[model samples]
Target: MTARVGVVTFPGSLDDRDAVRAVRIAGAEPVPLWHADADLKGVDAVVLPGGFSYGDYLRCGAIARFAPVMGELVPAARSGALPVLGICNGFQVLCESHLLPGALTRNRSLHFINREQRLRVESAGTAWTGRYTAGEEITVVLKSGEGRYTADAATLDELERSGRVVVRYTGGAPNGSDRDIAGIANEHGNVVGLMPHPEHAVEALTGPSEDGLGFFTSVLAHLAGTVPAGADRSG
Candidate 1:
């Protein structure tokens, strides 16, 4: 059976459709979940796609954290019953929701950076990154204003110690993120958040490499009980 993947759509979600398409391309059944609903409908995993929700007021992910949908995401993630992946603005929401560590601040230049960028897979044990090898480099689109990630030094130390920093910019910092962190994961590896838009780079005609396909495929690979052999981060 195809793994059921849930993609949540909030009022201002811009990439929900693309996220669903990416899920479908990864060979999963994409379930459309609403931001207002309190149920997951029994999905095996979920993806919070990018977009400016609640107008990024009071912080990007702050308002979405209280959405009824998250009411189901937090504890489910804690118990490992369901896996959650947040992309771009969704990453901000995940952090604000306390599902992941650190906070996203305004980009270092205070300008939105929209371009294809290179990143390295820094961790392999996350719900969304199992298909990648440690230290792998991949190209994906980066577009956001509040993309800088900040955390207390102690938390950064903890993440480094526990191998939780999942993805980092390979060629220096893009947004002045502490440690060039592009993505991070929770302790159980069931939750992941990243600033780049992986869903945007799945097709080769899109200029940026098709390296982003692994993001969605990783979840499916996990469900299939097969670790991808070609997903080496050293590339």
Candidate 2:
């Protein structure tokens, strides 16, 4: 069966369509979900695509947190029944909603950053990253203002020890994210948040590399019972 992945679109979202296209390229069905609607459209997984939701007012993803859909998503994600991936602004939402730990702060330079970023796979155990081995380097585009990831020392230490830090800047820290983190996952490995835009890099003709496609594909494979919810958890 083909997996149905839902891509959410908020008021000011710019990447929802791109996320849908990426899911299609990964051989899964893309389901467009509206933020105002409480219905999830019954997708196997969910993606909160990157964008300035609610105009990024008060803080990114803050307003969008109260959306009705989150009421459903939080439980599904916590149960490990539905896999959730949050990209860029989506990451902001995850942090705001407490689905994922830590917060995305402004860049140390306090400027919007847009560029292709190289990242290393710090943890391959998440449902979103089963295709890559730990320490593998991949390039994906990152564009955002509040991109820095920060956590208290205790939280950071736990993330490191638990192997939940899924991705990190390879060359060096970008935007001053602690431990060069580019992505992270929850304890169940069902929820993941990354600062880069993977959906923008799924097609060969338009995508930066085939690398980004792996994220969508990995989720499909995981649900297919081929992987024990991320068999490549080897770090």
Best by TM-score: 2
Candidate 1, pairs of clashing residues: 136-233, 136-234
lDDT, candidate 2, equals: 0.88
User: Residue 15 lDDT in model 1?
Assistant: 89
lDDT of 2 by residue, 10-95 (tens): 99988999999999988999999988888888999999999899999999999998888888887898788899999999999999
Q: Which runs of model 2 end up more than 4 angstroms from their true locations?
A: 230-232
User: Residues 1-235, candidate 1, lDDT per residue (tens digit)?
Assistant: 9899999999889989989988998889999999999999999889999999888888898999999999988898867657788999899998998888889999999889998889988877766777777878998899999999999999999988888888898777778999999988877777889999889888877538778888899888876767432133222
Q: Give the candidate number with the greatest lDDT.
A: 2
Task: List, in order, the clash count of every candidate structure.
Answer: 2, 0
For candidate 2, the 10 contiguous residues with the lowest summed lDDT are 226-235
TM-score of each: 0.94, 0.97
